[model samples]
Target chain A: MIRLEGLTRRFNGRTAVDGLTFRVREGEIFGLLGPNGAGKTTTVRMLCCLIRPSEGRAFVGGYEVGREAMKIREIVGLLPESPGLYGELSAYRNLDFYARLYGVPKQRREENIERFLKMMDLWDRRNDPVGSFSKGMQQKIAIARSMVHDPKVLFLDEPTAALAPDSAKVVRDFILELKHEKRTIFICTHNLYEAERICDRVAIINTKLITLGSPSQLQREFGSGKTEVQIKNLGSRILHAVKKVKGVLKVEVSGNKLLIQSKDPETVNPRVVEAIVKNGGKILYVTRGAHGLEEAYLKLVGKNEV
Target chain B: MRFDRVWEIAKKDMASVRRHRYVLYGLVVMPLIFAIVVPMITILPFLSAEVAGDNLPPFAPPGFSVKQATILAMVSLLSLIFMFIPAFVPSVIASYTFVGEKINKQLEPLLATPTTDSELLLGKALGAFLPAVGVTFASFTGMVILVDLLTLPIFGYPVLPDLLSLVILFVYCPLIAILSVSVSVFISSKVNDVRAATQLSGVSVLPVLGFYFLFLGGLLKLDWVELALFAALLVLIDAGLFYLSKMTFQREEILTKWK
Candidate 1:
């Protein structure tokens, strides 16, 4: 639903975003990962038509960014880094004001406000001024405000940055619900665990696209393929037999556990288990190692830290 | 331009202003003091007592009776000085609306909407303009009534709804309000702090104050010709300031240049 080709933006003499190229498909949850000053917010602003790209072109919902900014604004919703709400106004008035700006009719505006506020669990406090709410509640209201018009694509910048763990879970589940409804979502976040849990695909960048793929795909490409095996009464005899198994590239012993590395764990795991069983070792369980997307992301963007 | 969008923004701004206690105090109190208290304290004493010709203020015109001339001079000077009320009141409201919103980061989402730049500017201008003008008119009405009631026994005729009152209330107040709003817009774009924008916007009323002193110092008279000329000059300045403000209110600059 969004496409960027060599998209770049410069402020004064500094380049905020440089030569970015990527595509997000319909109904896909695309996460944008970058360190500070990596141009994540700049990229989202370009697509939202809040700022024009300095060079190249981009299309959001089939309308060119600079040429048809109004059209793109009509079809897309953006939650900026800050909630940016009117603190003196009630939550209902805040959403209603935006609904009018988007040209939503009166009847539909009321309905959408009611629905989204309820969805965010803010119906009970809709009459309170937003400034009085906790940071997490305010974030939920902001998320609801972005979806009030039910746009085709949503761009959220740090949707859960200030939320507590429980509130973050609520927002995450709400995003998953949006995914189930087949809407395109673009998220810019520093929370890698949340990104890994919800985003169908993610892109790591440092003024340029460093990597883009599903979380597992990225982990596989940049991470070590290590598997951990827990066995009862594990000793050097079983370790030697498991080490001799075909497809086993390396093996190490740690307490009653075995660390095995293989080019293809799916192919090598069965042989290693069989060798352990035949050697009279009681097997407990075998599982893949930790998700290494965080390591891959840090390694790629960690250099030249600002 | 879509007027509904404009009205929506204006209405929202008005609602926000209503909830701001300090701005509301400025809106109501300043006009009351300028329109009611100053006139009553300064003009009512002149109507109650007899005055010698030598004791008359310099601006009092000679052809009429002492009572007539003194009442007319007092009403005219008070009405002209009241123009400063409209000019000063809008700067307070506009500063709160523009610079306060910027400080709170509330402009970003509003700028992201489908509305055009002109619509947003016009909406905010009207939001500040309406209340300032409304209070000015209300205070002018109160002053007219109070002046006429006090002077009717001495002059045997009501001395209000005169050319000065009509021109100041109908013409100069609205233009000065627009000028103040436009100036506040420009100042808000240049400065990041609300107090700084408000302090800078206080300069907008300097021209009005200059005219008030010129009349009070017996250098200028309150007549149709002088009023028309001043109104024309103010209209030109208001147009130029509005255009400059619109040019400065670029969405891209606001998004990028603000720290």
Candidate 2:
């Protein structure tokens, strides 16, 4: 488990992470969602004992950040923003070297290295230099390197940032597997979909904590009260008519679907449909809550692009 | 101080240094010149044209012919150059291992390991120190053999491993290596580029160069007491620089302040 009480970090008087207070339950997959430069990575670094907080305190596995950095470092594995793998060394050597640094016994180090490599489907290329691997493969090796010591808590900062969709899926599956193994995973990501799909509890942050809850809870509480309507043969006249409908707040057209925001959807939905029907529009599909997380995230983190 | 952790870090960095060809070539070329080329050029002349005590350079034996004194001074001067080996090797390797790792972003995970800052510093310093002192010892061994074989028929004994040579080898080289490693560690923290770190750390040998220039200019006479004093001064400088470097290598400084 990880806990932070009013943790703050500042560089040259400019705050990077500010007054963060939260706790991640043991074995839960927790996501710290933020835009770029939102202090997500900074928060993770403070928790991993890579950097100390300037104000307040934090603990990982009951070990304080600044006081017991060595102990926190011993129990927590960090996958930094970059993979940071040694290019010239073999994958096995890289993992073994970390395991040794963590003081894992030699026999067990060997077993963990082989196990993680095989799990990543990189066992056959274990002997080759990591420089020879592709970006995704290098990421896999980096993931394996972090797990070499069999740490109880893991801090992953953008682990799937630049990976291909399939490779990202593989990383997600591996994270889910770690959850099954009862490891606390704190992930920092700008990928709202990934966080929504995998995180048991998600915290949206932009320098300070904005909101924290399960994905559905956030969606339900802060979900955009927007209705999505797919109209066949939707014309400019029909769009203009819908915009003129009373109580209709905003209308955004994405291809054939009209995402409509309204003050009272129960009353306005009938009027908007009547306006569309009078304008000779054909309706195909009606849906909501499909992208509830994205709307909620954009609402919470603001309209600035992540 | 878990020595196993230190050794592991040292071994890893050394293995990384082994693969960097530029650093490897620098390590190789300098030692070869110090051992083979410099000895042949400095001592070969004394085979027939040396052994007089009257015009002896500093630190020569008390009783010796002109030819013998010149040879001893040459050997002793050559020993002075031996100190340059430790002072130079670390710059090349440390630039690659320390600053280069920082540039390549390989140090975060390294710093994230459970090892304490002191262990990390000692391990890295040893990583640079062992290769440097190894090269110095190996190169010095070659010089000793060549000097003995060249001087045997004239002096009728090995003129090598005399008191000055022993002092420089046992005392001076290790001290110089420590100073250089400390300089490299300090410079590695200050400079982001590997080339800049290497160039800046080369300034560590400026003291050795100053001593060499002073002796050549007849401004210094390194008597036994002077040698001890110089070694003492070097020890002080090494301590101060080491303390500064240790402060720079702390975890927060490394993570937030390095770049």
Candidate 3:
């Protein structure tokens, strides 16, 4: 688990992370979503004990950041923003080097290296120089290096950034598996969909805590409560009749999809669907608009999104 | 304090450095040129039979002949070249070790490791120091073999492994090496480029050159007493420099202040 009490980091007169307060529960996958220059990396670095907080305090695994940094570092692993693997070293050596630094015993170090490599689907390439690997492979090896020590907590900065869609899904599934293992994971990312899909609770931040809740909680609290209906043969008659439904507030047509803003879509979506069915439009599917979290995030972070 | 961590770091760095072509070149070529090649060519003409009984310099001690003094000058020059080895090799490696790692973004993960700042510094210093000391000793052995071969027919004996050369090789070489590693650590903090770090750390050899110049210019004799004094000065400087490097090597400083 990780806790920050008014954690602040300032460079010269400018604050990089200011008064950030949050707690990531054990076994929880916490996503830190922010735009560029939004202090996400800075926050992770401070929590990792790689950089000191300029003000206030932080603790990881019950050890204080400044006072017990070595202990805190011992319990936590970090996949930094860049996959800073030594190019000339083999993947096994890279993992072994970090495992030794983390004081993993020889037998366990070797075992963990092989295990993590296999888990990342890189076991066959373990003997090869990391430089010879592609970007996604290198990223996988870097993640394996962090996990080789089996730290109780992991702070991953953009874990899936370099991966293709399939590889990203693999990493996401691996993260979900880590949650099952009860390891606290802190992730910083700009990929809102990935955050929504994976993170148990997400925090949208910009130099300070902007919002914190589960993905659904955020969607409910900040979403426009709109429904997106995929209807076959959506003509003007059906659109007019759907609008004429009592709870329908507004309707916008794009292709065969109708983005319907209803009065509390949870209680109103069924009536709206029935209204469309009666108007001779066959409903293909009806779901909450996909951009709820995104809209909330844009509204929270404002136009300074980088 | 945790020596295993220190050794592991040093080993990893050495592994990384050996793959670099330029680093390997500097470690090998410069020492070979100074130790084997220059001694074979330059000292040959002087040690030849025709050059005997030449005029001695003003610095030559009482009852010393011109040829003996020339041999002594050859010894000093060879010793100077050997001293430069330890000083020069570390700058090349340390530049790549520190500044190179910073550029590669390797230092952040390294700093995030549980090892303390002193442990990290000692580890990197050892990485640069071991190869330098190895290269210096290896070159000295080569020069000794060549110099003894060249001068054997003239003096009826080998002339190397003398007290001054021994003192410099045993005492001053390691000291100069530590100083060089310390300078690189200090300069690596300020510079972002490996070349810049190497160029800036070239200053570590200034003390070696200063001693050589004073001895050559007849202002100093590198007898045991003077060698002791000079070595004492190096020890003090090495300590101060290690302290300065340690001050600059904090984890927070490395992660935040390093550019």
DockQ of each: 0.86, 0.70, 0.82
CA lDDT, candidate 1, residue B6: 98
Rank ordering of all candidates by TM-score, starting from the highest: 3, 1, 2
Residues A1-306 of candidate 2 have per-residue lDDT tens digits of: 888999999999998888999999999999999888889988988888888899989989999999998899999898988888889888988998899999999899989999999999999999998989999998988988889999999988888997999989999999999999999999998888899889999998888889899987887678765788999998899999999999988999999989898755667788888999999999897766358678788888885333
Candidate 1, which segments miss by more than 4 Å at Cα?
Answer: A227-288, A303-306
Estimated TM-score for each candidate: 0.94, 0.89, 0.95
Q: List the candidate 2 regions with Cα displacement exceeding 4 Å.
A: A225-290, A303-306, B48-62, B219-221
List model 1 lDDT by residue over B1-259, tens digit each.
9999999999999999999998899888887887679888878888768878777778897789887788778888888878888888889889999999998888888888888889999999999999999999888888888888877887788878888889988998999999999999988988888888888999989879988898889888767788899999999999999998898777887788754
Model 3 CAPRI rating:
high
Residue A145 of candidate 1: its Cα lDDT?
84
RMSD of each: 2.2, 4.5, 2.1
Candidate 2: Cα lDDT at B108: 88
Q: Report how far off residue B61 is in candidate 2 (Å).
A: 4.6
* Weakest 10 consecutive residues of candidate 1 chain A by summed lDDT: A287-296
The TM-score, computed over Cα atoms with residue i paired to residue i, of candidate 3 is: 0.95
**Candidate 1 clash pair list:** none
When 1 and 3 are scored with TM-score, the better candidate is 3
Better of 2 and 3 by lDDT: 3
Candidate 1 residue A236 Cα shift, in angstroms, is 4.4
